[model samples]
Target: MKKITLLLLFPVLLIAQEKATTANTAQSGRYDTNKFSQMYDLLATPNMFRTASGAPGPAYYQQQADYKMDIELDDKNAKLHGSETVTYYNNSPDSLEYLWVQLDQNQMAKDSQTPLAESEKMEQTFPPSNFADKFLKKELERGFVIEHVKDAKGAPLSYTINHTMMRINLASPLKPGTSISFAIKWWYNINNYQTEGGRSGYELFEKEGNRLYVIAQFYPRMAVYNDVEGWQNMQFWGGGEFALPFGNFDVNITVPADHVMEATGELTNRSEVFTAAQLKRYELAQKTFDKPVIIVTQQEAEIAEKGFSDKKKTWKFSAKNVRDFGIATSRKFIYDAMAVQLNDKVVMAASVYPKEANPLWEETSTRTVAHTLKSYSAHTFDYPYPKAVSVSAADQGMEYPMICWNFGRPDENGNTSEQIKNAMIGVVIHEVGHNFFPMIVNSDERQWTWMDEGLNSFMEYMAEVELGTNFPSRRGPARKIVPYMSGDQKFLEPIMSNSEGIIQFGNNAYAKPATGLNILRETIMGRELFDHAFKVYANRWKFKHPTPEDFFRTMEDASGVDLDWFFRGWFYSTDVVDIGISNVKQYYVTETPTQELKNSRVKKGRFDLEKGPFVYLVEEDNKELRARDKKALKIEDVTLLAEYVATVSDTEKDAFKTPKYFYQVTYNKPGGMLMPILVAITYEDDTVENFKYPAQIWRKNNQNAVKVYATEKAIKKIQLDPELETADIDLTNNTWPKESLKSKFD
Candidate 1:
């Protein structure tokens, strides 16, 4: 008889185990609940606001500027000379009194205020410089000088010159919403940006006597005027980026015939610059997607190295719908190209680095660029430009529209470390990806760094993962962010801080927002939904100035998700995540015994005669229901209990049920942010159950919450939020039945 009973129990255990496994599987898959839900909410919310509010949209404003620049690079003296005519278009609503031109390289001049001002910021997040004086005091600072300013008609205009900035006063006030034409002559001293500690220009490599030129902010350009920030007057103080109005750039760069050059525009004169074989290969590259073909081959570069050409050829490029322009040119450049098909359009992905940047650069840099194009195109719109270039520099990584400068160098023996390789690939992918972010998305880096930086960084993380089969990414994943998320509370700041002054500035401004977006894509919002909504935002505001509200509204409008809480918590507040499973109570119920003895006791004055007969006595001496009793109790002993339960009609059957066991679980939220609670229940038979509560479960109770479960099996253990992907800063209190019992040492 005992063997037969055990056999019957085995089937029940099997059934319980099956249900438990299914529940645990479901629980483990529910991640990033808050992010996607918020994305959904953001998509659902409607907007009545008329104008867009951020930096991105203005950068997309349509305008065209035709530039005729005659530039000369002096390798001997480390200086540059140029004269240019600009046909500027005023596409904004407000009128302009004078056009502003950026003399970006002038920041390296002795008189520039940037180094002095930035050096005073001792609490900067990145490298701080006390050696500014030594760098600035160096002779031949190689800064730009603006000599003349004139209209298309040759009449001179009054202009003011400051270090790295030149203001050209217009002869006549150009009214709002109109185009103006002008020209200027300028030259600049070129200092080594890598070792000399400036934002733009180049660094001197030890062996070749060759300088890597990552020339940007090189031309005089117009300032932006929009609803947000009125005029982005934030001066460039070393590390901050740019804010400029959108326009076309028709530039002609003159480098030695042997030098390989790439810039921010379409190569209109490729036949004049590239050999017949190279041009043929360039045409073939459009059809080749598997790998890159060499444009300026290693053999060709070595041959060019043997003999320097004095004869120069002008490479003309015309870029439409670009906000900024930059160029990189050197005889030392080794060039390779790959093609990426986006929306069926063949976009070229190129890499150019010196011999010092080879081996590692040859492997990852080109592939990383190709990966970025594919991933970003899926998340945003297709690549609009014909080419995206990544050039290797030694110092800082900065972005332009068609080209960007990245930092990564091999060791002395042509050996590169993995960290260096990853950093180089990551930076290259990041900067090239920025062409889609602020370059075309047109967010104002001067006002809201996250609008472009955060968004681009988010894409960079995704691109990195997609580039390699098992890429070890440093940011974006939930587990990867725990150290940063759990840092000292005093150092933490919300991602919505003003661009100019932010504490823990890099974390608050870049990493957090990027992580938040990653959480949205992987955990909160599933890829399909997030990708669609993001692509919609990109397409909707492709050539327009998009404010934060525009992004917030568009995301919701497209995805039909309400995301106000997400924007409020992640972007607006420095909320930590510290939710805990507070408590769990288990109980079982059975029928009360009959009261024949109670009546007899009442007559003996041991019971209250006025009390109801169905009353369950609280006496601890009740023998029928002992403390050690494990048997299921019966309801027949109490006739009144049976009648009470029988009184429920068919209509009330839904509310009336027999539950042998009961559990009350309490959850607590010690952090400012709210995330979904994932609960796992394990039974005595090695069975498990899982339940999920939305982030809104804590809306009414920020400190703690309560939940009750009814089950027949005994609960063995309970766990809360098992996966570490939520970026929960604290994990010690996550499990119920606390495991840590510290021993007190005297």
Candidate 2:
């Protein structure tokens, strides 16, 4: 690949790469800053619950929290009411006296502390709805009301509310293998996602007098209880997402009679909710593998939107082994679905959108959903759920169990650009691909956002590429993350940093990790090895909670590749790759050895200077400004070579390849991170040859690495990371005859 970068001409934007030195270089007592050091100090000690191999240990146990809920939508009042019975199972060995429940909705409460954590600034523009929600309206009547908290017998249970978390005081010590059940009732006003801003809420189609509700984190939920962190009771400060345990769900949601809804599970009352024509189309969708089947056509949806039904209908859904729940309900929804076959199983790719989403959504939504499931499945593991649904909502893209909400709206005039179309398709793929990551693999996003978002983004990149050729993906390329990784150090944070502490959330949490994995797959570890290990991890921890170490360990253990250097360099610290070829010297196969080689021979007592076979040659500086003969030197031209050849055995003669050319290449590492050295050797014939030197090349030498290349053909030019796969920050020093920069205007 040709070198292409705007930095070539823009010298002011470029800064000299600060060299990364080894810990051994320190004069006296010092901290261990070895980039290749084991992550023993940072990783938790392996125990019965989590093993060193990165797979779940023999005694691994995760608590389960089952939920049975009754939910209702008061569209007129813009409120959501819910009552739920949470059954906690003590799968862990330890007994518990209290359980923590997360009231995520509290982030939007009138007295929410979330607003105080952020530093806000005034923007230049706002729509009427934004202004109304900002000033004209009273404080949003947000957060859960907590109408009551009762035991299975309906007796009130003692519970205390502290910000977004609720502590349920147990009547007795819940012993191991035992279970307890309790109920809670709550209600709260839903925000308009476009105006108030949130992952989930309503999108108003004011002219049509209807609203589309895409809701999650709308009810009180149980927190995760595991061996790693007994109770993941991290406060929902808004930046940190949720941490929940996996269990079954039985929910009944009531919405207007004219509305169509999809939730986290299979709709049990499809017969009662769907019209005859809709039922027929759904059956066809199950068999339609080529394209989407329109379950609710735009005409029908438009007719239904006009009828604000006074009555309500209940949508019954049941799900198994899911960490969380979500629902999208609206009378203005145009529903479509298609069947996708994965191995022996069949899954549905579904979508729901309003007319405003038009032309764009209808063309790509469900297809992108299908493509994502297939791509993620092929890369990771099979899609475990029965269906993956995409719901269209403006300005929001959030994932749930089997469903997620996406944003991609064309203009009111139904006009869309290539950018808009591609973005919408990419968002749908990303949101739907989340199912394979945190949804099934079950990583705690509240503690480490990259564990989910970053991994999902990487998978999303693959899926988007698999979806089409030359796709304009925003992440997962090693070179794409160079700007952020090489930017101001103070403004950057390591990929392992906590969710709320990150300075560049998107670049740090999503792009960096994705690019790191890409580097591992494409450059460090070959695809076959990397893919097998990645799939092993997904299969090992499916439906279980996995920590960052679990993923790190599994990847190494399964691939039989030691990635301590990579994980430590890329994740634990903010490091940039800046390896380049500083110089290259060519040597002829003369019997006269260089002074450095003669010194090594003297040390071994092999310097026979008084022997009859003495051959001496003079040296010439390569700075003579002349090119050399492009052919191998004949053994007859140098008497010492003929004498040596006659003395060596025929077997050794073949190995010598006499009269060969040798080039000593010097590579200097100025960046903090170490990467596999990829050298592209351009021969005099203009034929390009590439060789990769593993990152271990720098193990003995902390700074500069020297490797001698012997070839039958003369070399023309030498370059490092010719394909830009290592995310090297400096390209100026990469070539042997260092490449010069020229402005385009010149």
Candidate 3:
């Protein structure tokens, strides 16, 4: 009887196998040609200046610009004036005919093109103050006023000004491997930053009749000159930030004797600037790692605010190898400082805020700075600078070299909300983390904002999470960016867009790329590989400018993985991820040739009814033949199968695992993005098994992919992306037995 069954099934099996082989071989030449190709066209070709290995090659060179400035702030007049002497070094391989300086404050000029470039629309409702500022108030005569341009000999030099940029023509061409010295004296009216939103300026306290100044981009600066874009003298449009060269700064700032100030560098004359008690506290702060020491008490600040000292004090600072300079000064600032150990270095974490900022800023600001440095250093490189300062300025969040201004103030009654507290902490971390990014790594912010802002934001999220589980981080999660990514493509811009061209600045320049890196760390590359590669990038580009290619190549080079597809999909395109299980089928194996197999054989005309070893059941037609076949094929009468089982070894019998169930699951990609497929299968025995398919599974057929599973238990249900790891736009089709949806009317 066993022989009869085997003989009857042979012909049908052979015919099915032949048909499958023929179908598979029919479309031999039709294949996806770009499944695993390198990103040659999309990437810049590797050259001597910047190698394909993502490191600066032997011939790589960068220009340098150093500055010595004397600045004065007229608190009563709300104005700032500076006279800077710049010593420019031509380190590049090309000769320099002239030097370009960036007047970033010119964007606020009354006749500046920045305001004209903005398209205003009449809204249905507007705030009274906003309406007045927009329609009724006269434009302020803002921007830089250059007094004179002179050479080292004090003789006037030829200069030209085109809006925000100034060209200083040298008497003789500044040859390669040479240095030139020039001087510029300029001043500009400081705008009311609270009324006019900008990266720098002063915010007034109407009740106190005083001002708190948070200043940056306040002086004429040299633009970046590198292999990518020689002399990146891009206009300082209001949205996109500056692109300055790394240099040492010796700045002398003059302010009221009673006012406290914090700048980019260490104070050269701490003894002359601080009182005896404040100096004692400042000394103690260097050893106080666990908590902060108050340098200037709130009572002292309040008393100083009322003095309005006529005498001026010179607070000298000297910073080394920094991109730009910034200062925050006000008599109302209550100063605090603490020490944090980052690896082997003990760095100061400090904050300068008004009494209104406590007890929130007092508790969190400096702590956030310290935490940011630790978290960022753990993932990238250590904090190379001596100090990180956070100054509380209303409606301000901006980062310079070692100092940054943050916004988070309590109500007039010293009351604060959880949201406000989190915002303060989040912004502080973000700004301090920037010290590791463009401040040190020194990427070109004018050309690629993401290279600085996006990376810093990603580091900020990590620091926030390290703060605690419940920390309210605004970005860095895969799911947090889905709303923006899956929104109307018309309003959405790719992450690779220019800083000025992005529609949603915060979401595009900060959140999306950060989220992409978070996804890379948590899902695609895993934390170990991603962190190592990220550290390599941070160290490799420290104090040097790196383009997008340097970051992309270094990540792959360090991780030994090809990530071109990831970069292309996440950065270069506005594609959303939506992978789902389209269909699922389950089958069980049987020894007998069932009616389906018999019909397949009959259709192909490959089986005969009288063939030897024939097996049949009473369920089919022809009652007489069915009865005879069933009687001959009865289990007890199968002597050939019994003999074979008796002859088989126990070990061989144990090795056989006849799978009880087989599943063919098909995954469909409704969205035009590629991601790994994560599946979880639940069986009848209440057990679960997870399967992870690499992103390459969809390389051949991007729209749909099928995977087969052989299991011991019957599959009850299948779930895709069970952990919500992927940013799948749609969840409706992500289950084998589709989830039921009810209509709104129902």
Candidate 4:
């Protein structure tokens, strides 16, 4: 057949073959309805409170709840007692009939339903200790013991406790632009965090008869009331975190006289609590920016641990515009602090750890804190608080307003492996970066885990990489997420899932979204645009509440890029990217028709030969046609072509270059996800050219696409996603000449 005739028939033959294959198939259906559409159905409609541009609308308002607490840590009893007076200012347009308080300590109650909600399965072999801890231990007395709830006038207020939440009824509906004052007196038995597994508690050292307390969620806190989910009274089921309104705090914590304490706020009476020598060291640390200055040396801490001081000292602290409060206190803590300059302001980076955390904690904890503040502040907003503290605890990595609990303990002899060291630094960065995420940016972590954990983890990866090469980052690299992205569908959940609903907590809540943002920064949007948009999101939402829509809208609005496709695929669906080169064909230029064309014309009774100037295509494999053309024709022998070239203008000739080779490249997508097509084309001269087509290229053809290119050099090979930027799952079909697979033996 003639080349033109064969080309025309190819599509028809393909249609026939496709129809035959469909007839033989047992199961066939239409396309998935949820695959390609926008996320309108899944997202709430934009309103005046939150505009389409992702900025807070004119009507946006947030409530404020200030606290004045007098907390006492009963070290001998392993308990916490507090009397808090909350001053709530209602700034919303609507009236509040009642106030919801989060009693998170109730999650550990002996009668708590959290344990019942989990499913227990029998193990093949269980250790005697594990079996006893799981099934034999007597239930401990847990949850808050509410003493009294009273109004500002000292009148008893009506309240009811249900699970992990409490409702306080008011005498009248609290009007907007009004304030109310109430008091709550409560106490709870602090569990051993190492044994009970909690965000905060104490780690006991039986041999030394000492304990390190890392405390949070220790008091009655007000739940967030905002435009979205009016009253975020979601019960604390243990996985999803808190959603609290921003407020100021004045806390007076009374503990053992020998204890060294670091809390969420600035210590108001530092001189009163610190000795002469310790006060001098802390003052020196405030000016020392290069390295940490020991406020309480390990030797002093060890000596203090031996003495059970009967006298108590009260440490007063006051924090402004913070959402939560946490404190770490221990007589065994070796306290150190250093200064870090951030934009016109100087902030302190401090570490409080037991002697067991020496070497690793002393050498890296304060440094990691300083690095995190610099890195996160550069990307997001400045560290607004006075200090960022990292307290070493056993198997605990959790964040609060100005302080966080990190796990990095060396052996008894102070020796740690590289893996342990990396984990220490990584966790410190991750927890400290949280100050920029939900802590100040204030996303609701109860509803969306990725908003806080994922974003913070991504920042952690960046800080880790900036710290040094071979930093062993755990997330925020495209390649690191491949195994989870391509895992069994049954075991996978989209990043949009609730914290409690996730199947694989680590991958779903942290790794996937972090990797997605990395891909956006390095591959999709480029670093410049991504960083600017990210900073915009951070600054716009700082000290405020932001929903998922606000974040998605702010990124696009700031960057001038439409990223709905990315959000829909990466966050809303369990889709994987898999683009490959399906087929390739090469063609050469010719002036004369071959024998097949002549036969085709004669068979069709057509005699239009030599009627007009025409160009023909000859396949590279057609040797007979090439041999005939070589013997009968020359470069200047084509009369029609020479006539065309002679008539063209000088400007046109200078602007155009004749192509020596023509190529038809076809790309196919076997996976459901859509991503930018990054191609690397190689020439026979050992040179390469790269081209990137936006993801919109798949709009017209979702399954496959055909692209034609003309080049001066013969095409040698082609590669799709040469750098693995899209997290493409399957690489076997990514190349034109498929790479060979190695056998197990080989």
Predicted candidate 3 versus true structure: per-residue lDDT over 1-746, tens digit per residue: 32223423122343544546465565647643453456776788889999998999998988888899999999999989899999999998888888889988888887689878889877978899888998899888888999999999999999998788998887788888999988999888998888887898998988878899999989999988888878888887888787888889999999999899999998999999999999999999999999989999999999999899999999999999999999999999999999999878999999999988988988889988888889998988889899999999988889998899998889988899988988988889988888888999988888789999999999898888888758877899887888888889998888888888989899999998999999889888999999999999999999898999999999999998788888888888888999988877543333344565556555455455435344322222332333333322323344544455456679976885644455667899998878889899898887999998988998788799988776777788899888877788787888878887575598
What lDDT, from 0 to 1, does candidate 1 have? 0.71
lDDT of 1 at 169: 76
lDDT tens readout by residue for model 4, 1-746: 21121112111111112245467667857765644566677778899899988999999999999999999999999999999999999999999999999999999998799989999888878899878888899878999999999999999999999989999999899999999999999999999988887889999999988999999999999999999889999999999998999999999999999999999999999999999999999999999999999999999999999999999999999999999999999999999999999999999999999989988899999998999999999999889999999999999999998999998778888899998998999999999999989999999988998999999989999998898767978888787888888889999888888889998999889999999999999988999999999999999999999999999988899998878888998998899998999988765556666666445433333334444234555555666456544332232555555566666679977886666567778899998888999999988887999999888888878889888887878778889888878888888888877776475499
Off by over 4 Å in 3: 1-35, 593-658, 741-746
- Residue 253 lDDT in model 3? 98
Residue range 610-653, candidate 1, lDDT tens digits: 54343232222334544533233244443555565566667775
lDDT of 4: 0.88
Question: What TM-score against the true fold does each predicted structure earn?
Answer: 0.82, 0.92, 0.90, 0.92
Q: Which stretches of candidate 2 lie over 4 Å from their true place?
A: 1-33, 121-137, 589-605, 611-619, 622-632, 647-660, 742-746
In model 2, what are the clashing residue pairs, if there are any?
none
